[model samples]
Target: MSKIQPLNPERIAQMAAGEVIDSLGAALRELLENALDAQATRIQVEIWPSRWQVRVADNGQGIPASELEQVARRHTTSKLDGCSLGFRGEALHSLARLGSLTIQTRHADDAHGWLATYDRQGELAHQQPAATALGTVVTVADLFADWPLRRCSLPQTRPLLTLVQNAALAHPWVSWQVRQEGQLLLSLWPGQSLQDLLLQVLPQVDLSDLRYQRIQEGDSDWEVVLGLPDRLHRPRPDWIRVAVNGRFVQMPEWQRLIQSVFQHTLPRHRYPLVVVHLRLPPEQVDWNRHPAKSELYLQDPEIRQEQLRQHLHALLQSGSEQASRRSLHLIRASEAKSVYRVTSSPKSPDPAPSGQPSTPLPPLKALAQLYRTYILAEHPQGLWLVEQHLAHERVRYEYIQRHWQPVELQMPVMLEGLSSQAVEQLEQLGLEPEPFGPNTYLMRRLPLALWSEDPEEVQGSLRELSRCADLEAAQVAVACRGALRNGIPLTLEQMQQLLEAWQRTANPHTCPHGRPVYLALAEKDLARYFRRRWGICDRPISDPKLGSWWELEPLGDRFAAQVRRSSSASAPDPKDETRSAPL
Candidate 1:
């Protein structure tokens, strides 16, 4: 066997450090993530032009002075022994190659500290005694100094501040401070909650329509804070943020869930602003699977998406009801359509003729329920599904949710003793159930479908709408309860009528949530399944006796018995063309 050759520590360090600075921000984020994993409650990051320095000092137990040199070197870490959760030597070794890096630490058990530094070439530049407090301080500067193009591309002080600011908001428990050219840009105290942190950074936020929620499913936990439907910052919901295990990432599947919830509420081209954080077990999610880690590998992305959609839809229905009551004077286009001219024409006879009255079915042809999601009715040759409650409430609430219109439909409705902020958020989301006389609003009008239903339940549904967000998130709050009452029976006539109306309605295939209303099985597919010729006769031969036939004898030359079978034994013809004269 050939002798083994050892890797030069200097060469390995330089190469790794180069790679780290190449993906500078991402690499820094990884280190910061490690700090968080370490249970650090406070983190401070600083920048020096092309030179970048990050200091993460935590109250957690510090490393002993004796091991400080080893920790600063390549492939050394204290976090790895407990759980196989983070990097081994990759993070530190990378940092060392890009610049002059150093680590200083002191422990409560040890009175002294040690300092070690690595130069740009990955060689150990120095090791010395140092004075330090009872914690760890890691500093790295001159990032990418050896690579001009990469160094030039590094963000200036201000942009870096923004990056740090965003990260700070994500972890509310960590007090954060930022400085550029000695000018303090962001200095924030510990936040009581995510909302509290948001208020601190985005002071101008219109919380009047905000909603927040926390949902747990098995090993996954999600926190969602959303704005009301109409109050979305853009025509469509654009402001959406997804965080997995506290690391902000772009998750397209998650976006689908939010879009499904906002389908009809906002106008085209507009998007909603949402911030959602998901805490999933690290093993279940493969962060290392990708170079950027922005994209995630979810074991059940579809299921997770559906869950999010359901949660949002429920909120929309509840919010609409409350808003409709408050703005009783408003009128929506849908409410106007409710006053349709009852056609008197006898029209076509019942198509099915199964004693089901030839009801006035809409141009729609089919209705499909996806895991019992928003009902989807066919959109002409296509499919359309309506959010039973959102569509109903939109029409009802739009009329009632007006600011200056007269109470033409919904009367002021009673609301439970909701908090003041919740009431404001409701109105912002277009819920304005007016106060009838203290705590109650005059129950006047409702979504046309809800007219015959219980006003008490409608009110209660709106009250319990967004269980996730503050009751202030009007649309989200009311959407859940406002949805089709689970298991409520509908008459065939009612079902038919609702289906018809939905088929002609805009966005027939989706309710307010972007969930599909129905999936169409094309005509060609039906023919293929039946193995029938396309638009041609070659009809199956039914009666051999009726058609001309020649008799054949057996091999023995004996005369064969001519047994004529009836054509009736063949498959039945779809078309009763027998009534037509023989061609």
Candidate 2:
């Protein structure tokens, strides 16, 4: 007996519908593509309160009465030219199987519109004379109701709204309106600019601070509009939009290009807002990679990515400089494809100019301490408020990473008669022990951080040493133990030394555990908190205690000079004089 069998036609249709209409977004995308292919100048979408009913209407060339019923069948499409948005006639067939689908359409010369409904078998179940304008309107209600698994697994509202937004962004020339549960979510008139669309996309940014850059290379065009370079986002920014040939797409290659461009400019914890739109010939892209068409295939994507990177890099560099037009290349008739590059004007990028005291730590003027925990200080680039303990921890961790030493155990003497394997492992880890009596081995030394560990912890760590995966695990453990603890009081002189030490570490932003060491506020930020006489900011205060805020101010350096003169007692830093920092 043969086990293989053909699936029932209705079952096949239902399964195919699941593939094409997996989510509400995918269903809307197919309808949207059809509307765009129709050259619709106006489109409207409506969703019911339960999100089970959706209607998409478009004003464009509609189906003729004779072929209206055939549109429900699979592979029945008029776009044999390969230039249209959607060609495989699976969407309507899928919709028919997924739910009850109704389409109302009429041509311009027709007397009136006709309504047709499709059954689950990809057949026209009903048809009748209807009233409507010269266009098409498709309404699909109770979507995926027959396929309960698909309905239960998929989201309706968010996907539908996101799909509509992308469609609106791609077809900026089309007037569009979207409503959910009888309330309007988005309404846009035709002829709105890309910048106008982006304003709604990134509502947090000021409109004026957004910068736009355009590049035209032969038949392809690229536009990258973004916020100011200093605008920092903590998470991967969802506002970044990418459109290729008038269709918004999510491509990893393009995403990589955008992200890599800002890698050097921004810290690891931050991202920038970039809206990129590229227009190429229709033949250069294929949108059939995924069921929803979110993935895109580009012609020579690497070349496009490199070209886009150079253009964006030049834009950022130029913004850093005044809008001087010094970096952008003007291609002449003979050299039209010359690549553009941005180079520093003085060759060596701006000199760390004099007049500012030359030091790793920018000279800072101390302000009043905040709540006896944070130290407030002013520098040229910004006003800095530093957490007292974390700042010292950052400095000490860097020092420990550079300077290693052996620790004497404070616990019981090393175990006697340990297995040779344990002894070998401990020796391999640099914790050498020697036998003083019969099978009595004593711990000579261990990593300083582990010296004070309970005997059980030491034994456990040694037992697990071979299983430790990370090479930095040992370094991090030692550094964490060696770092300064919180609640330790610091005089003004000790605080200054700690701040200077903090500035010298390679990565002063974060400690070994990746927590921030300090919070930096700009001069304008300080002004926002404290009202001051703007004109007198540069002048020395008449009160002996308050010095000029803008100038390099001192924090008890004079008092420290006096203390050094009077007594031989050194500053408060633990092991400060013993170990010099790495050069």
Candidate 3:
């Protein structure tokens, strides 16, 4: 017998079915594509999880009654020209092999509809006249019943719902609904604009900062809608959706291109929510790259990529500059508010009477500013060097934490261009913006930190804060932006005030951004570096007796003598004066 032989018909059928209709999601996708290709205006999907069955009905030009028997036959289709989503002609045939397949349809030319059933071999087994509207209904029962393993591995309802939603997004003009066991899972009406459809699908995303653009080239038209870089970002790139020629497909090169445009704008390991649709002439794209028709090859990919990159860069660049200006205006407003605030003068510390306990951090006297960045101070236990910027950040962060109360505004501010979901999120974060009009809110109060901010800037900041992953991250961003910058001169009184404020913070060791606020050099470490005989040096270095312990012989003279001795000797010692303990 030959080692390799042709497979039997039953085994071949099993393998082919496994490839095309592998999961419930795959089967649903095929049905949806068929409905869309038929120019469906309304589609409904019903599922029975207990029986692993699905039914898809569509209002479109359906199959002809006379050709109903040939619908499920292998290698039979009307979309051989590659313009339609399903050109392989194997979807119905493979589905029939996996389970019981029944299709009921009525063509415009036919007087009535016909229902046909197919067996596991994909051959028509029964045909009968049926009363139905001018459309098609495909039902698959007991899917993968013959293959128990595959049946158990089928996907759950979520993937099926996702498939339907993707189809709806790609064809927003069509109405769609999905139900499971008589319970509605999703419903989308027709005549929804693209922006409205996106907002409906992605309720969690804040579309207040959304940007849209359309471009037309020689034979291709592109529509790009996306969220600008803000506090909103996802840990994964799954939010990026792309559709080509009315078909939702995976184009990784384009996804990466979009990411590259926002690489510098967004933080590391974060991605923006972007939706792109490209409509090109059929001849410019090859849709036969993948078996399921999820991937495609586009002509002149490099040129298209460059064009998209330029467009995104231009838009985002202008957006970033505007954001910066808003931030600057807010900061200046805050500074103005601080100037008029009443603050008590710093009082000198009184000596502890009868030896009472002191605070957690010992009172330090500010000596000088080192390099105009770090503050040098004298502490009881050691010499302290504090990063000016980090210390100020911690101070501001804690102040905001303790004083983050909402104050009633004298005049109610009208915040426009906010989504309903955005308003809800703002309320959850303690803004309590009431709905005033369509995509507008009436804000009667504002957070204490944002009180002095302009109404427009406050609106922008609130939108950013609402979209952030959490409260702490938003606080960090605000504190970081408003903190004192490094390399700026500070007076002795200003330095002292900053140090006093920092000392009162609950977490003074590290800044809100997790950077070390100060470095402490203890007396013992300093003594050890000077090669002192005893661990502690209580006397001053100017004292003649303590001079030997404070000063060390020049290292260059010792190194030179060692090198001369080594040259005169037969061999140098492995370890010499060159190796010394770290200072």
CA lDDT scores, all candidates in order: 0.55, 0.68, 0.76
**Count of steric clashes across candidates, in order:** 64, 0, 0
Judged by whole-model lDDT over C-alpha atoms, candidate 3 comes out at 0.76
TM-score of every candidate relative to the true structure: 0.50, 0.55, 0.55
Q: At residue 487, give the lDDT of candidate 1.
A: 48
Candidate 3 backbone collisions, by pair = none
Candidate 2, 1-583: lDDT as tens digits: 9899999877776666788887677777888888889899999988873657778899989988988778989878888776677777888888887878999999987899999998876688888999899999999888877666766654657767777777776666788889887898888776455666666644555555567777799988887777665543437767567988767788776777787777756545567778778888878888778766667788998888888888787767654433312112111211232121223321111112331212344555556567667887776867666777666665665555444466766564556566666566666667676767775677756655444446766654444432333435545544555455555566777776777677666555555565555565555544633335334433344444665433345534455566677676654564433332332
Q: What stretches of model 3 exceed 4 Å from their correct place?
A: 1-3, 8-10, 317-583
> Which candidate gets the maximum lDDT versus the true structure?
3
lDDT of candidate 3 at residue 455, scale 0 to 100: 67
Query: What stretches of model 1 exceed 4 Å from their correct place?
Result: 1-16, 50-60, 81-85, 120-124, 157-159, 234-238, 318-583
Write the number of the candidate with greater lDDT, choosing between 2 and 3: 3
Q: Please, what are the lDDT tens digits per residue for candidate 1 over residues 1-583?
A: 9989988967666655555446456555655666666566776665555455555555545667566555556667666443333555567667776656777766778877767777644446677778886666777676666767775565655546555555665778888776554566777788756666666666656555667777787887877777676654564443577777666777776787777678766645678877777777666676655544556677777777777777676666655334431122222322232323223331211113232212232354334544443455543333333445544432222222222232334445666676666566555434455675565543344433233256677667555541325322333234334545534555544555545444333333333333333334334433444436535443233356754223321321122222223344565675722221111
